[model samples]
Target: MTDWWLWMYVAAMAGGVALFTRWRADPRGVPLSEYRVAIAIPFWSGLWYLVMALGGGRAEVAGHTVYWARYADWVVTAPLLLVALMLTGTHSLPGRRWRLMTALVGANVVMILSGLVADLTTDGTARYTLYAIGVLALLVVYGLVWGPLRAHARRQPAGIAAVYTEAALLLSVLWAGYPVFWILGPSGVGLLGSTTTSVLLVGLSILSKVGWSIVDLGRLRALSDRGHLTVV
Candidate 1:
């Protein structure tokens, strides 16, 4: 069952690469930067899932088997995902976005790093403390995305704004599940068994990475077709 979910993740990512490549071949008006960042998300994710599937990327942390590679995957891909969303939101306006982008990326990194440390810590107090910190970091990420980022995106043309809304909503909701799963899974309170946790995480990864990219790119392509795409 674990192999099934692991390979499923690999296959989903491979499919994302192919789908994006086909769309990128003739990008119409979508920026190459977007395509590159979009492609990198799934590419990195697929590689890490491949690593996990090959019987590596696991560590015995706090008496639980932690897939550290998943955190490694998040450290890389999560930033890239935010970058993609940042590009989408600021497709026409880039000048004032760097600050928000920095906050988003910084908070995201802290979230992933803290989660990793929490996983590795054996002390219950330390582990939960780090988990709280990670949760706070995630809240910061959410505030940036929904507050400042969404506000900026709304200033875009209607098409671009709509795309940003859909993409941002999709990403935000999917990401909220990660911490819940973490706290419930073997890593936290062990309310969820490892197998169930792995399956759930695999499902979330597929949506947040592969599924979200497809929606983002597809909507952007539509905007391009409608002459809403700007060279940013």
Candidate 2:
């Protein structure tokens, strides 16, 4: 009956489709681990949102009807996403040390957690402080991706490199939007209505979680079809 319900419907469908496509399709040549982790984010995210959607929708925290479920989804899915990137990166850059990948994953979780704290906190100064920390941690994640991950992707074949590069860029842009929406809030910027904001937030989750998952996995499937994938 509401926009959020529709948004969740689309997200749930998209996430389910992504996983089904992954499970049903033959690997061709894509690394088994890459396929698994790439599919994992949306799989978990879909379940998270499905449960939230069924459980009376938006949640309240400190008098604000915040989308805490989305943040909780990010807590698990964000790190899983980075792991997929790292696994995909290994196709060309074989020496993708586990430590750097793990560090990025850890930093992303911290970024999400700090932002959650910022959102939950009632104190303006403390909120801003947490937001700043989250932003800094997020920047570190970008630095890791662009600096090391980019280098690794570049070393990969032209096609795999392209896919990895686009994935990295797509993730950076999409993931960055979360904080912008969080900062805007219901009383924020005055650019969007509360209902509209909720719609856009759900829309964003669908895009980042469902859309990205399907598209990136599609790329892998394409690579596999072309026999470009390595048996990692």
What local distance difference test score does each model get? 0.91, 0.74
Inter-residue clash pairs, candidate 1: none
Model 1 misses residue 201 by how many Å? Answer: 0.3
lDDT of 2 by residue, 1-232 (tens): 3446645655675555567465547766766676666666667776666766675445565556666676778898888788877766667554558888788988998899998877777777888889889989999999999898788778878888888888888988998887787677652344665566667667777777667766676787788788887665
Candidate 1 structure quality by residue, lDDT tens digits, 1-232: 9978999999999998888888889898998888888888889999999999999999987678999999989999999999999889888885756778889999999999999999999999999999999999999998999999999999888899999999999999999999999999998999999999999999999999988998999999988888878777
TM-score per prediction, in order, is 0.96, 0.87
- Model 1 spans with C-alpha error above 4 angstroms: 94-96
Q: After superposition, how far is residue 227 of candidate 2 from its true place, in Å?
A: 2.9
Q: Native-vs-model 2 lDDT? A: 0.74
Q: Can you tell me which runs of candidate 2 are displaced by over 4 Å?
A: 1-24, 56-59, 187-191
Maximum-TM-score candidate: 1
Kindly state the number of residue pairs that clash in model 1. 0
